[model samples]
Target chain A: MILRLGADFLVAVLFSLWAGRPGWPGFVIGLAIGFVIVSTSDLAFGRPNHGRRLLWMIHFAGYFLAILIRANLQIAREILTPGFNQTPRIVRYPVQDLDDLQVTVLANCITLTPGTLVVDASEDGRWLYVHCMYAEDRAKAVNGLQKLDDRLRREVFSW
Target chain B: MDTVRDVITVILLGSGLSFMLIGAWGVVRLPDAYHRLHASSKCSTLGLFGMLAGAVVYIGTVDALIKAALTLLFTVVATPVGSHILAKAAHSRGLRQWDHTLSDELADDQRDGPPQV
Candidate 1:
């Protein structure tokens, strides 16, 4: 709670600076407003995991950005090249261990990556139906997605 | 300093534009909805990220940076959700895959009983 308040204070100062009103008065005013807004919203939303969410956001930004760049390049190359070296496939990825939110996050992460799309999830939420643009080696593609899942499990959703 | 900023902006904006064009081409040229979604989602997201970076650098204002950050955040969150729903709808609507598609593991799973998770 104290840490969350500290972060709110810092963000308030940043906002003050961004608004071209950087000063003690501005900082104090921003701090009060930021605190009230952030606290009220956080309470209203019933989010007890603010710290983890922030960590996930930071990690996700860096990790997703790196992969996004690579995906762009890879897809561009495939698009520009002549012969059809790509094989499209839809694979059902198992995800029963994860809760609903985790499963949803995992599905979205797969969709966000290049060359893959989440077609559907099983009724029980145990299987993620994913379509891949390049599936030359089926095991390799599944393994790649599994790797992403492990990362999300270990890094972002770690308790 | 201004010249350096201009150089950075050009580099970022050029790549962003290239990705956007690639995405558009993929949408038109790709065989099916799923394939096109791959190109559209990935390329457009990265392209937007690049363009936002360029804008933040060129403008060089704290206000601009904050706005850019918010836009980037929204893009990151929204794109995947949008694509997921579209892909789900396409599949449910019985959209045909490209003729060359080698496997339908999901269908096979549905037939054979889903793998135990």
Candidate 2:
């Protein structure tokens, strides 16, 4: 944990330098910010394989960016064109295996993606009620969400 | 180099403005609140990011770039969460879906009691 904190501090200092503050004061500030971030995260989530986690985070970010852009374009088309191709409905998605943090991340990802927004979670957190804009075929809509869930489970949370 | 930067900025700003316009139009055009939220949240997020990217590019300063990047990051994390909460509240309060909606599984689940473990 201490090693991770040190590494994070160094990276933060480097970031400060890259951000155009070239001085001892910037380094001190960076170290302070880094300490706060690292400690807070450590408190939230226990120590894990940092290198593997960072790699998966990068992977997730790239995949998420592509989908995010696609979602924007899809909405733009819906707006620019004359009529709507929307078949909105709410579906109950099972979230049985995921813990709280994983569920939160999954919910946010679903909301940000194309045509899906998380409406609520069941009292037990076993299911997420999702509002899907394009649900003409219920199975397909569920399948799309299932795919995202599988990827997140495999890539990010497997550690 | 300067010309390239200017052109990029123009493109970014133009796209961002158009996206914001479309989001506004969608809110006016869509059938219901839920659908409107989709348009407003998604488009505005991309629109804001585009404008921020333009600012970062135009300024070409470390401070400006970092600030813009931080704003983008926060928006990326916050926008969806905010929209989710709003949508959840709307659903719980029985905000109506569009008339043409195909199914209502969530309503069914709510009415039928919680699912079996």
Candidate 3:
């Protein structure tokens, strides 16, 4: 908890610095904003799971950024190249283990990533129908989704 | 040092514009709605992010930096949700996928009957 609060404080300090307040005023404002951030996150995301949650969140953010960049490059290549290499398909991706929030994150991440979009979900919420822009091999596409699921399950939703 | 910052900003802005151009081209050239969504949403998200980043670097002002950062953050978070809702609505409305589409398990499952769960 202390570490998480400290991290939030650091982020708030950076924000204050960016906002042109430096030195003592910035520190004071950072302290206040940091407390608000910590409390608000607790209220929104439920209680933190030890100090590890922050580390996992940082890891997730890095991974998400990497994937976002890769997704864009892949799309750009497709757009610039000659003939279509796409073999699009809508595949059912099971998400029975994930709760509502986890599922929501997964869906959004899938949509944001390379060559995949979340088109729909099953009535029971057990499955997400993803449209893959390149599904030349079905298992390969499903495995990509599974890797993302594992990452989320291992990192963000471990609690 | 000023020259270095200007160069970096120019590169960022140029790449951003090119990405936006590619996104527009994709939208026009792609065969169907889902493919176009794939193009427009992802590319434009990154393109706007790059442009905002360039703005932050070029402006070199605290207020502009904060505003650009917030804009980028909100764009990153919101774009995917918007595309997801659009894709779902299109699917539910029976908007046809490209004829060459390899498979559609959603339609197959629906055709099979009510969802098992």
What CAPRI class is candidate 3? medium
**Global CA lDDT computed for model 1:** 0.82
Error of 3 at A155 (Å): 1.9
Candidate 1 error regions (>4 Å): A1-60, B111-113
In order, what lDDT does every prediction score?
Answer: 0.82, 0.84, 0.85
Q: Residue B53 in candidate 1 has what lDDT?
A: 97
Error of 2 at A116 (Å): 1.0
For all predicted structures, in order, the TM-scores are 0.81, 0.83, 0.83
lDDT value, residue A23 of candidate 1? 52
Q: Which one wins by TM-score: 1 or 3?
A: 3
**Tens-place lDDT digits, model 1, residues A21-90:** 8655666778777777776778898866555666676787699778778888888988888766679999
RMSD in Å for model 3: 4.7
Provide the clash count, candidate 1: 0
Residue A29 of model 1 has an lDDT of 78
Provide fnat values for all models in the order shown: 0.74, 0.67, 0.74
DockQ for each model:
0.62, 0.60, 0.65
| Lowest-sum lDDT 10-residue window in model 1 chain A | A48-57
- In the predicted model 3, the residue pairs found to clash are none
